[model samples]
Target: MHQGDPRDGAVTGLQAGDAVDLGRGTALLGCGGGGQVDHMVHALRVALGADTVPVVPLDGPAHSVIAVGLVGSTTVLEEKTPSGRELPDALAAVERWTGRRADAVVAAQIGGVTGPAAALTAHAAGLPLVDADLVGRATPRIDQLSLFVDPLPTVTAAAVTSSGLRIVVDAPDPRDLETVWREAVSHSGGWAAFAIGPVDAELLAGRAVDGSVTRAVRTGRAAGRARDVEHLAAVSGGRLVARGRVLDVQRGGDAVSFVHGSMAIRDAGTGAVVRVEAGSEWVHCLVDGEPVASTPSCIVVVDARSLRPVSTDRARVGDELAVVVLPGAPWWWAEPHRTDRVAPRAFGIDADPVPEPGQRPARGGVR
Candidate 1:
C-alpha cells in the first residue's frame, strides 16, 4: 500500500495518543465533506477542554442507524458557519418526521469540512459517532453512497437550514431526495442537514473508515517538523509525496465543487519543476512530468503552517500545500473494479497514469 504522505524529509516525532485526541475533534468538524480539520480544531478548543480525548468509532446498533450530511452550497456555509445548535435541531426534526430513534449518526461524506462537521453533529446530538461513512473521500453527488447498496426502502429525511427553514422529503429513493434538497439549499443560499438510510446496525460495522483520527494525528506529528511553509500531505500509510509551493492555479470557483484544477509545483530547496492536475481529490499526481499517484487513493492537502487538511471549496492559489497520496482501503483498489470509477480519466481526461520515471505502476497496466 502507498504511504499516506510522501515528501522528502526525516520522519518527525509523533505519538499515537495525540493522534487519537486530535482525530476525535477533527471528525466532528467535517461539515459535509470529511471533517475539515480547521473547523474541528476550532470546535475542539471551544468545546473540549479536558486532555486525553477518546476517538469514537462509527460501529453501533444498526437498527434505525441514520446517515446524516450537510447539503447546500459549501460557499454559503463557509461565510456563515454553523451555530452549533442548528445541526441538532435538524436531526430532531428528521426524527420527529420519521418517528425513528437514531442509534448512531454516521457521516455521509468524510472529506473537506464535512468530516469534522459530521463528528460535531454527532457530538451535539449526543449520539455515538460511527467510524463508518458513506464515501471515504469527497464525491460530487449525494447518491453515491453505499447505504443504497441493497436497494433499501424509503427512509425518512429532513433538510433544515440554519435560518429555521426546514423541508422534509421522504421517498424510497434517497437520490431523488438529495436532488430536491440540493436545489432547495442552493436556492436559499444555505446548507441543509440530511438524515436518511435506515441502515441495519450490523452492516454499518467494518464498513466505515476507522483509525482516521489516529492517522491524522500521526500525519500532523510527522509534518510538525517542517520549519517552512511548504506543501505537506498526509499519506494513508505514512508515506511522503512531494512538498512544494503553488506556482499557479488554473481554476477556482465557489460552487462547492469537488476540487478540480492543475498547478505547477516548484521544489522548495532544489527549485525543480513539477506540473500536476488535481480533481475533487488528488486523483493524479506527477513529479517532474511523471505520474506518482492517482484516485481510489486518499490525497490530502494541508496548510504547511497549520499541518491541517484543506477543503476543496477553500483551496486557493498561492496556498502552499503538501500533496500526499495515501493508500485507500484495499476494497476500492481491488482488481480492475475502480479503474475508471474515480480516476481523472473517469472525469474525462485522456492522460494515462504517468509513473515517476523509475517507479512502477502501483496497480493495473501503467507499464
Candidate 2:
C-alpha cells in the first residue's frame, strides 16, 4: 500500500472517520441535489463492519475499474433500504457482459450517498475503491458520466434493485443505455443499483475524472475548520451568489422532468432577484435576468444561519438561504463533445453555459 499524506498525497486507505468527512464534503459538493449523505455513511459502516476500506490511486497498478451507484427515487431508497448485494450483482452482470473481471470500483458521482454507497460496493466486492469518480458532482443523467463522455469498445450498464429485479444494457449509444435503465428503474421499486464499465486502465486513464474522491475528503475536512459558510467558501473555491429568503418556488409547466422547477430568492442587501432553475439538480442561476451560473457548475444553497447545505426538493417559501457557486469538474468543458451535452440547453433549458469562473479544485479541495 502507498503511504504519503493522510488526506491527499499518495494515500492508500479510507478510514471510517474519513468516510464521515467525505459525507460532509459530498453534502457541500452535492449543490442541492444528492441527499441523505448521513444515511449512506451509516449504511456503509453497518454493512462493511466500520473498518478501513483500501483506496487505490488512479495511477496505481493497472486494473479494471467499474463505476457503481444508485438511480431512481432516493426517497424510496430511504424507506425500503437496499440489501447491499444489488451493486455487487450489477457488477457481476457487467462482468458477464464484458467477459472481464473488475479489480476495483469507482463512485458514479461524489455528490451524495452514491460516494459512500459506491465505497460500500467496493467493500462488498472485495475490491479497492478507486480514488476517482465519473461525474465530479451531482448530475441527473447517466449519459453524463465520464465513462459515457467517451466512446468505449465494450461499455455496459448493469443494474439491480434490492427487490431482486435486475437489468443490463449494452448499446452503442449512451442515451439508449440511459433510457433502458431508467425504464427498468421505474418498475423496480423506484431505485436500482448500477455498475458501468469494465474500463481498462489505459482507457480509464483518458476518461475518468481523477482525484475527486480525495477532493471530497479534503473539502469535508476543511469544513471542519470553517468558522462559517463564508469561511468555507473561501477555502473551498466557491463564491457567494445570493443571500436571502426564498420568495417563490416554480414547478413544472409543460416539461415534467424529474422535479423540473425554479426557485426565486430576493437578495437581502441589494434586493436583486436571484432565480435558480433546476431539473433533477440545480442547473442554472440568474440574477436580475442575467445568467450567472448554469449546469455542471454546482449551485449550492444552504441555511443562512447554520450554513448546512439545503436540498433542492426541500426548498420552499419562507426559507432563509445563502447560495454558493462551486466549480464543477473541468473535464466536462475541456472538449466540445462533452460541453455541448452537459450544457443547460442540452437539458432543455434555453441558456448558454456560463463561462467557468476559474480553475476548479484539483481533487484536493480549493487550490
Candidate 3:
C-alpha cells in the first residue's frame, strides 16, 4: 500500500484512538446535523477492536476510489441498527456495476456516523480509507458533494437497504441521481448505505477535501480537553457568539426528509436573543436579527455545563447552551459557484452567509 509523504503532513494511517477523535470531530463538523456518532462509534469500536484502519494519502496509488455513506433521517437511524454488512454489500454492488474493484474508500460526508462507517467499511473490504472526503462537513442534500462542485462524472451509484434490497443507478446528471436515490432511501425504511464513484487517486485528490480526517481527529482531541467556551473556540477555530438558555423552537413544515427547524436562544447574561435555523443541518444563525453564521460553514451549539455538542432535535426550553460558529471548508467559500450551492439563501434564508474572520474572499465577496 502507498503511504503519505511525511514532509507534506499527510496521515499515513488511522490509529486505534483515532476513532474516538473522528467521532468527536465529525460531530463538530456535522454543524449540528448528520446523525449523532454515539451508535456508530460503538459499532466501529467493536468491529475494529484494537485494529487500525489503513489510510491512503490523497497522492497515493492510482486505483479506483469509492465514496460511501448512509442517507436519511437521524431520527430513524436511532431505531434501526445496521447489520454491519450494508456498506460492504453496497461496495460489492458498485464493483459489479462498474466491473472493477475499488482500491480504497472515501466518505461522502464526514459527520458523526458517516466517517466511522466509511472507515469500518474500508477495513472490512480490505482496502484503505483515504484521509479525505467529498464533503468536509455534512450537508442535507446528496448533491452537496465536492465532486459535484467540480462536476466530476459520477459513473455509477449503488445503495443497499437494511432488508438487503439493493439498487444501482447510472446517470449523466448528478442532481437527477440525488432525487432518485432520496426516494429510494424513503422507500427503504428511511435510511440506506450508498456507494458512488470510481474515480482514481489523482482525481479524488483534486476534487475531495484533503486532511479532513486528520483535522477531525485533532478537533475531537481538543474538544475532549477544552475547559470552557474560550478554550473550545481556540481549539476548534470557532467564535463563541452567545451563551443562553433555550426560549422556543419552531420546526419548519417542509416535508423534506431532513431536520428542519429554528430555535430561539436567549443570552443568559444580557437576555439578547439569537435564533438558529436548521435544514437537515444548521443553516443560519442570527444574533438579535443579524446574520452571524450560515451553512457550508458550521454553526454548533454546546451544552454550557458539559461543553458537549447539542443536536437540534435534542435542544429544549431552559437548556443552557453556547452557540459557536466555525469556518466552513475553505473550498466552499473560495468560489462563487460553491458558496451559492450552500448559501443561507439556498436554504431559504433571506441573508448571505457571514464569513469567518479570516476567510479567503469569495469571488463575489461573501455571498
> Could you give the C-alpha RMSD of every candidate to the true structure, in order shown?
6.9, 4.1, 2.4
Q: Global CA lDDT of candidate 1, please?
A: 0.55
Global lDDT of each model? 0.55, 0.79, 0.80
Residue-wise lDDT of candidate 1 within 1-367, one digit each (tens)? 1122234221122122343334533332231235334554466445534432223454434355667777765666667777776666767877887777776676676555555555566666666555556656565556555555445567567777757677777778856876788778767656766676445667665344554433444444545554443323222243456566778766543233345676666766667665556554455666777666655456555555665666544556677766555555443443343333444565444566433323444467342
> Tens digits of per-residue lDDT for model 3 on 224-305?
8899977898888788888888999877555442547898999877778999998777788888988878777788888888
Error of 1 at 114 (Å): 2.6
Instruction: Please tell me which predicted candidate would have the highest lDDT against the true structure.
Output: 3
> Model 3 lDDT vs. the true structure?
0.80
- Better TM-score candidate (1, 3): 3
Which predicted model would earn the best TM-score? 3
Once fitted onto the true fold, the runs of candidate 2 whose alpha carbons sit more than 4 angstroms away are 1-11, 47-50, 253-257, 359-367
Q: Judged by lDDT relative to the true structure, which candidate is superior, 1 or 3?
A: 3
Error of 3 at 120 (Å): 0.5
Q: Supply candidate 3's per-residue lDDT for 103.
A: 90
- Local distance difference test, candidate 2: 0.79
Which residue pairs collide, candidate 2? none
